[model samples]
Target: MDRLTAETKIAELTKRIERHNRLYYEEDRPEISDQEYDQLVRDLQELEAKFPDLAKEDSPTRRVGGQPLPFFEKVVHKTPMLSLGNAFSEEDLRDFDRRVRQAVGNQTVRYVGELKIDGLAVSLRYDNGVFVQGATRGDGTTGEDITQNLRTIRSIPLRLTRPVSLEVRGEAYMSKGAFERLNKEREEKGEALFANPRNSAAGSLRQLDPKIAASRQLDTFIYGIGELQGETVESHSEGLALLEELGFAVNPERRVFDNIDDVIAFIASWTEKRPSLPYEIDGMVIKVDSYAQQEELGFTAKSPRWAIAYKFPAEEAVTVLEGIEVSVGRTGAVTPTALLKPVSLAGTTVKRASLHNEDIIREKGLLIGDHVVVKKAGDIIPEIIAVLPERRTGDETPFSMPTHCPECGSELVRLEDEVALRCINPMCPALIREGMIHFVSRTAMNIDGLGEKVVAQLFNDGIIHSVADLYYLHQQRDVLLGMERMGEKSVDNLLAAIEASKQNSLERVLFGLGIRLVGAKAARVIAEHFGTMDAIMQASEEEFTQIDEIGPKMAASLVNYFAQPQAKAVIERLKAAGVNMEYKGLRVEAGEDLPFAGKTIVLTGTLSQMSRQEAEEAIARLGGKVTGSVSKKTDLVIAGEKAGSKLEKAEKLGVAVMDEAGFLQVLEGNG
Candidate 1:
């Protein structure tokens, strides 16, 4: 065909294919058969390949996936993806309602109840009604960019019905049937199976290869709006309706209730109807319908006061405890696990449950080969709830904690004030292996391609012995390629990820060190305080204790860890491998005279000039802490437009208050 003809035809085909995609995936009404749709896509692909410049960004052909990404870029959310406080019983729901009513006074309150899909929480951003970016809600404030992967999910519209910009939050999930089919396919291919639909969905979205995510047949239910432009929404229910009109898949089961009682009833009905649905929902999310009411109710440090999640009671099943297995962790703590006869529970086949420790084993009175009741706690972890002593056979054996380390054959010792037996040998293979796994974990060094299985393989094959050894793996590219599943491309990507991790600033290295009593947050705090690894190594316990959040125990742990000769040797090796040792995050010079220094501040309502997170980061840079809620201890409250309870409380408590303009002035050092 001619260039003009091809361009016109491409546009026609693109529009037609997208309409069909929406009908089939979103509306569940397909006008064409699978083969017909595939043919349409093939025609579009051929034209697009011939006239690459004429190919539209929202073309349906993109859903087949694109070139693999080297790594996911970090995305800072405009609004934080805060988790909801949970309600397990009726009282918790009522209590939440009471709190909401108390905050709003005589104002009538309506609620929007939505099925909390058991899947990964993701944020989708659109520019002028076209899908621009999508991300995982990693740690609320930050997320990983998965735009390419998200575009492949057919239910997610590449273009909206109208031109508008917005950021929406959704649960990306795999249906039960899809999960089963995927696991069946994996089983046929001799690949490991996903534990459940939720896991399968999460794993699919995180894949660097968009083709894998596309193949998973993932779906999404857009529940909330993070940000909106060009138009306004007065209530959450209205917003959901608008989302539906804009070509987003808003769950049809959501209901608006006049009172908490009706909401409770709605939740109860869903409890029985949950399993009947193709998708899995672990709970119901109850939110104040009115946007104004939600603003009036304000938010706590972690979750909004206007919403709560009512978790369904865990599903229980009776199974035989076939055997017991124990494993050592990076911390040297030996944990016991129950090997159960395969039984189905909570939409997954259960063959293992956590025994936790010897104390838990004895407390539950568990015996190998005995019948036990197992339940998934929060529908995630499998745990033995009760043991049926009556069902125990004469051949049942009482399990005991092993005296020696399973991997290294070292004698195990119970530490003071700790229940789990520890393998004190620093050189224990299991300890080293687990530590290496921890080092390469997402929150630590974040080496992308080195998963648990790969780490274990590398360890067992004598390719790597310590976390420091990971930096040297590039030297053995040929050897890496020879290993199973590690192709030239895989080895290159893994090495690139490793090299990228080296520049991750001091906090990641500190966290990756597997220091006792040091978590991700603590690592950041320590890194910021010390400025450099050498400074941290030289810091005295008293210096560490001087920081308000660092307690004596943590201070001692830091001091002891840095004091060790082996630790120093590892640090030197890492430094030699071109790993960055200095803090690269925001840091302001220490000064008591700084306006926000040593102050506990509270931010309330919406700011016009900047996001809440931006304001918080500014305060943090100035050595001030931003907390939720208002109290006498709060040095100042930054009140924005529509400031609510926090503002009133600050006024009543005689705490100082600043408007957005004044806050901005102070941020500029002009106040």
Candidate 2:
């Protein structure tokens, strides 16, 4: 095609792609599949590559994010981001309404009640329809510029529908489903899990690498406007409407109430229905709808007098600890659960709560038959927070850690570094069963139709002894079909899923192995370094330690794990079954003219351009070695936001200290 034709085609593709982005992100209604959208993007990219000079800076491709800033620049809000005073009860809400009415001289009024999403508050700025900046609500005065990271949130429009300048306030939040998925993935990787959706959303947005933020699938609700040009709204509700029209996501659950009684009713309704929502809501934000009335009410030194947050009461219940149940995980760690007298807590009936470990049980002085305060941790998982010593009867039994595995009768031992008592027997039936379950989990091999029930049935019936046995199940199709609840079609689907898992990356296989201390992140690191299961199996402790994130303990664990005859046999069987054992990700061989190639690079402090994980992965892809510490042997130290002792140490050691800008330059092969 000619350059003119290509240019016209690119424009058409950009328009269509932007519209689709709006439909999918802003409206939450996608007409086209992901594959179709990707094809359009690819077409535009191809055209842009062909007609390079015709490309525009504000092109849709910019949303993909190639510009990486080293650190976030500070942004001073044009208007101070004020906090809202909180009301804990209906009386408090009434008092707030009374004060507002008094200030407005008992004029006719309306209040907008919105669900207070538990998330990070951020400000977005636009210049002539183009999104220019985004920042956190730091101290309500200044915040770190997170423009690039914000752009990755598809819900946040890159350009306004109208060519008008505006500044809006929003809450960037991760949905409950996304949060659960993220935490599950993190748990599988053996990384520290985020406590709640709020923290996860905050962390995801703060990631310097836009790609990291993009992968998190974050959404936002523009609640209020900081400033707007060429427009005027009489009330907060009208401003929200204008924001929605300008391609910003506004929470649809907000209600405008004519009376405080109605507003209180709205708050009460949400307190009960909050859990039903896809995201978490901590409270209801009640604001005077009239912009004139808000100005009249004015602001205090810290918060707005016009708005108040009615926080929901904590959901807690007193329940009797009937008994302690010990369960073994795939890692052989024995967890103690509190079997509680069924009590209604939060949105569900709680019959059990996680005691976590012996430390927790001892710390809370929890005893069987003792009354305990049970509450949902982060309003999700039921947990025993405290024991009421006064309610303990003489018949209460002191709970003790199990001396042996309940399932396999093997001796349980507590490792020096660990708090939980673990069953060390590799061949223990409980460990084997749990290992099989973990291997087929969503974050592991991801084999479908192999849930807890199916896995238990397979194990109890002696149909499968190890993870490798799953691959060979196709040969036993008739036998599987003959089992209760297992039809021909069900067996076929199960076999198909198992077969499909063979093509998974070596990282998944490594994680599925249930190696001690090997999480999803560690698995990926080890797999990428070794490039194959055979290479990992042959690697020595010293070789394993050479990889970033792998330490002496982890190295020894991997070495000891691979040395096991049973483990090696399982891997061999899997290999024989045509299961892939090689890493399927990008590999950087020894001889590349990359700037980071063959260098021991240590990242210190917070990187503003990308997450530490993203940076490490990128460095590895460029054949660089990433380590946690700085030493004389360190070739380069990339110090980011708040460069601490590591930076000083790097300087003292005469190691090269590169700033974020320098790191970006090096990444571009300009170093």
User: For model 1, how big is the CA root-mean-square deviation?
Assistant: 2.6
- The collision pairs in model 2 are 189-519, 189-520, 208-609, 208-610, 209-609, 209-610
* TM-score winner: 1
lDDT of 1 by residue, 1-671 (tens): 99999999998998898899778766888999989988999999999999999988888888989999887777879888999999999999999999999888888999999999999999999999999999999878678999999999988999999998999999999999999899999999999989889999999999999999999999999999998878878899999999998999889898999999999999999999998999999999999999877866768767999999999999999999999999999999999999999999988899998888999999888888999999988887899999999886699999989999998999999988988899989888988899999999888887888999999999999999888899999899999999999887889889998998888879989999999889988999899888999999999999999987799999999999888898999999999999999998776556546678878998887788976777888888777888876777999999998887778878889999999999888778732
TM-score of each: 0.93, 0.53
Candidate 2 per-residue lDDT over residues 1-671, each given as its tens digit: 99889888988998898899888876779999989988988888888998999788667776666554444455668677988897888999999988988766647989999999889999999999999889999757657788888887778888789998888999999998998898888899999977677878888776656878877879899999887667868789999999989898899999999999999888888888987999988888999998766755656767888999887886899989999999999999999988999998754568888888999988888778999888875466788877788876699989889799999999899889889999998888889999999999866887757889999889989989999999888888888988889986677767777877788789989999999989887998899878889989999999998886899999999999989999999999999999999998767764667777778988776677776666877787777877756678999998887666567778899999889998787677742
RMSD of each: 2.6, 15.8
